[model samples]
Target: MAFSATARDSAVAEMNITPLVDVMLVLLVIFMVSAPLLTKTVDAALPQIVPPSLDTIKPLQMQLDVGDDGSYRLDGRLLTQSEVGERLAEAAISDPRAVLRVHASSGADYQQVVTALAEARNRGIANLSVQH
Candidate 1:
C-alpha cells in the first residue's frame, strides 16, 4: 500500500519573528554608526593669569549692624543710611581696599541691610560681606 499526499492540514497562524529581529539589528547598527556625529562641539579660549605679590596687606573691615528697630550701626556707633557712605569713605581712606561686613538682627527688615550695602558700594568699598 502507498500513502497519498493530501491538503488536510491547517495553515500557519503565527508570524515568523526572524525578519523583525533582522530589522531591529539593522537599525541598531545604523544608530551606532551615526551616534558620534550627533554630539555637540564647543569652542572656548581661557585667559592666563600671573600671580600677584603675597605681601599685600589684608583688606580692612567695617561692620554695619541693622537692629530690629530699623537702626543702623557702623562699627558699634549708631548711624543713618546716609551716614554709611560717609563713614565708609573715611574708613577706606585709611585702607582703600576695605571690606564691609553687614549684620542684620533676626527681626530686622531685609531692605535695611540692602540699603546699607548699597551705600557701602556707592562709597567705593571694594569688599563686602554679609553676616548672619
Candidate 2:
C-alpha cells in the first residue's frame, strides 16, 4: 500500500556501454590489420598495331554446307570431306585472304562441322565463319 522513493534512487544510474565500445574498437583494428592482405594486383599487356589501308581488295567467299547425312558441299556442289579440304586449299592458294562460311543442317553431326573447321585451319584458312 506504500512506495519508497529513497530506495529507488540508490539503484545503478549509469549505462554499462564500455564492453560494446571495446568490441567495436577490436573489430576496427582487425579490419585495418587485414585490409592490405585482402587486396590483389594484376598486370596485362595489350596489343598495338597500325590500321590497314582502306583500298585493300575484298576477299572471296567460300561456302561449305554439311548435310544431315554427314555429306559435305562446297558452294552448293556436293563433295566428300577430303574434297572439301582440297577445294579450300585450292581457293586459299589463289587468294590468301579467302573467307570460308560453314553451314550445317540441324540433324548433322557436330563432329563433322568441327572436322570441316579443322581442315580449313590446317589449310591456312583464317577468315572462317559459321551460319546456323
Winner by lDDT: 2
Writing each residue's lDDT as its tens digit, candidate 2 over 20-113 gives: 9999999999999999978966677878665676336688898899999999999999999888989989998998999999999999999999
lDDT of candidate 2 vs native? 0.90
- Give the distance in Å from residue 75's predicted Cα in candidate 2 to where it truly belongs: 0.4
Instruction: Tell me the spans in candidate 2 whose CA falls farther than 4 Å from its real position.
Output: 1-56
TM-score for each of the candidates:
0.56, 0.58
RMSD of 2: 8.9
lDDT of each: 0.83, 0.90
- For model 1 the TM-score comes to 0.56
Look at candidate 1 and tell me the lDDT of residue 33.
91
